[model samples]
Target: LHAYAQVVGAMPRAFAEAHPKWWHVSLKVTDHGLTTDPMPLLDGGTASIVMDLAGGTISVRTAGETTATIPMTDGLSARVVGERLSAALGELGLAGDIDTDRFANDDERPFDAGAAASFWDVARLVASTFEEHLSGLSGDVGIVQLWPHGFDLSFEWFGTRVETHEENGETTDHPAQLNLGFYPGGQAYFYSNPWPFDADALLGVALPHGAQWHTEGWEGSILRYEELAGDPDGPAKLAEYARAVFEAASPTLMA
Candidate 1:
């Protein structure tokens, strides 16, 4: 709800004074320290400004359908961001349209115009599918497959290429991702590259079941693995953290 709050708090009295009769604002906060439905603040007419910091997004909406969405990062503080937002609005000329009924007539620093809350409920909804989106390239030659193992693990296969099997013990043929396979596994598996055995040095050969490797990063490095495994929650945790960062950077918009 931080986004809505920023817009509400920074709203220019001229805007509120212009539409005081029909326009309003409100906010809905949850226990998880997230905000949603910032429009409610305006609809309720109780508060002119509302902030929604949920689902990895910061959004502020006015009765005129004018909205400000900002991406969030964990490294930044809310107060500093608020000040920056106020200045940005002033520059954009939107600040003058902010509702003023709920704000003091002489409020100069828009950041301190009203109260704020964490919109946790809204956060949960957006963070739901983050873990499912862990797919990317590892290196030029090898194939990187992400599995939900003990930890987030990626297996890179050089030489021949990696393969998969079905329940009937028959090998299945599928196009390799970028000439490599990028399979998304569980959290633990993704966190730590875990497999049945060590498959390094065995290029073009698919090791037996439960064999994978974990990748730390890419620095022109080439390491092979026969098999590997790790913590399960790794991928989910990483996804959640990333979503949180994105949410802080900006607000969500309905395209």
Candidate 2:
């Protein structure tokens, strides 16, 4: 998906606001691969991008049958994939100066079928749990997206504005938000981060089953997948952990 990230990131920056929550809201797992929610093209038409790890290709399809593909060769590094994808996009008239370095690295792990299948299972479970929690909340929620940078599937929920910053000479508001996602990092886990607050406040607060408050390099909380793999109530525990952290942090973060 690092290649697909390059495609979307290369699309006109003008489309950024239209996808502020940048993760594809309707992304789903088809028998073939992971697909993006339909996106509006600069030409005023719609297209959906698909990342088919199974077929080793990134596909572009119009609302109709017209489709284009960029291959993901078995031995190519991620940077090479992005470059090839960019050239392909240019040939197809999709111009994006594609940023080749958003969470860029040169790891040489060849694709693994077993690992992919297992990771997809965890990703689906996490997405479902997030859907369950978001349905009960009235605050603004973001699309549950899989970002290529961190290779993490995440989304955000917004609350009252807490601060603002100037970016590229434009002012942007920063709201209190709870970001939730599944990441198959060095270890697979469910990660939750509520912005604008310190981890110290919840020092003694009990986490859901199999969770811990981590503050090594950042202030987010985590629950290991290794711990939940055997739990009969894994789904419930994940949702409960999300709720516990959100409820514990929302008020003060919003203030």
Candidate 3:
């Protein structure tokens, strides 16, 4: 799934309008799976890449009603699949550079249709929960998206505060923000990390559902997925955790 996402992400990165926040490259959750939305083609048409997790295939479709599909089969290497996608785009007249380095794995991958379907179910639920949380917030909020780089689902709420950074003799100002994300990787977990994190103000604050302030490798609050699994009130508990982090850290972020 991660490999497929990387290839899908490369489409927008290579052809879509470059969003300053790179929102264009992030995949949006669809009813069946994830989509790259639409990328305008040089020929005045548009193209999109769709990962049909439910059907276990990656499809490339063009506005001209052309489509090419690559099956998600066991033992297909990421490189092979990427090559197929690139070739498909070429055949569709929307050829462009697909960063092969981003998915430079030659090892065969096992595809479990049942597991993929289950993941899609969980992704839909989590995306809905994230959106519900975002609706109550006032200010600039990003849409829930899945980042292919880390294969994490997340969104950000921007604060009024501006943070300044200097790099290579250039100075830039960026808005402070808080991210609520779910990482489905090893030991899956959810996190709410505030930019320019104020350790003094945020640490020691209580978080619900066994969530804790993690300051070891990174700074933020995290709640393991296991904490909510099988619980009847899992969604509610996740919401509470998100709200607690916001209430605890928003003040410092705005300050």
Candidate 4:
């Protein structure tokens, strides 16, 4: 699955100029898995990629040409899969390379089908919850997207509160926003971070079941998937947790 994600990630970087919402927005998710629209090459050809989270395979479909399949047959590493994709791209005359820099871990970690299924299930539930939370907001809220870099599915709500900070003796300014993300991490966590955080905002707030206000390394609230998986009311618990965090931070963040 990780190798498949890398293959899809490369398509965006290579074809960024062809997309209107930049390459980042092209990454999408379906009940089946993560998908990308057929991207156009300068030579009037398109390379479409889909990572079948359900099937455990990466499929490349070229317009007017045969589709290529690379199965997640056990121990396929990212470099090996990338090489296959590069050869496939060459065959179709697509302009791009399978970026090795951000390919992160191409190690031969065995695939786990059962765990992936559970992760996807959690993702769907959280994605729907994101939409529910966004429906009432008037701010600039991005659609839920799966960022290839971190392999985290997330959406951001922009608030007009910008802040300036000094980093390495250089000053930088950034807009305030809240990120609600779900990741298949070491612990599989859902996170909510309000930028330029007002630490006092959540000082007295109590997080919902399965959630905690995380302050180590970063300022944010975390909902551990392991805790939610065992809860019968997982969706409700997540929604409640998000609401609690947003409510606590909105006064300072949204004001």
lDDT top scorer? 3
lDDT per residue (tens digit) for residues 131-248 in model 2 = 8888877778876666655667777888785678898999988788888888777777888887875666875678877687877887778888888887778888888988998888
Candidate 1 — worst ten consecutive residues by lDDT sum? 246-255
Stretches of candidate 2 exceeding 4 Å from the true structure: 1-18, 21-32, 36-44, 54-56, 70-73, 101-109, 164-173, 198-200
Instruction: List TM-score per model, in order.
Output: 0.23, 0.78, 0.96, 0.85
| Cα lDDT, all candidates | 0.31, 0.67, 0.88, 0.74
The regions of model 3 sitting more than 4 angstroms off are: 63-66
Clashing pairs in 4: none
Sorting all predicted structures by lDDT, with the top scorer first, yields: 3, 4, 2, 1
Candidate 2 similarity to native, TM-score = 0.78
lDDT of 4 by residue, 1-255 (tens): 654575568766765445434545346777657877666766787777777766777778777664688877566777777777667766777755546665545688577888777767767777888889877678777788787767888887878887888989999877788888888867788899988778776767888885888889998889887877767788778888878888887767764
Cα lDDT tens digits, model 3, 79-127, are 8888887887777576667678987889787999998898898888899
| Tens digit per residue, CA lDDT, model 1, 188-249 | 12122212223342223332233323234521112221122233553344444333322221
Count of residue pairs whose backbone atoms collide, per candidate:
88, 0, 0, 0
- After best superposition, candidate 2 residue 154: deviation in angstroms? 1.3
Off by over 4 Å in 4: 18-26, 43-45, 62-66, 104-106, 165-172
- Candidate 1 accuracy as TM-score: 0.23
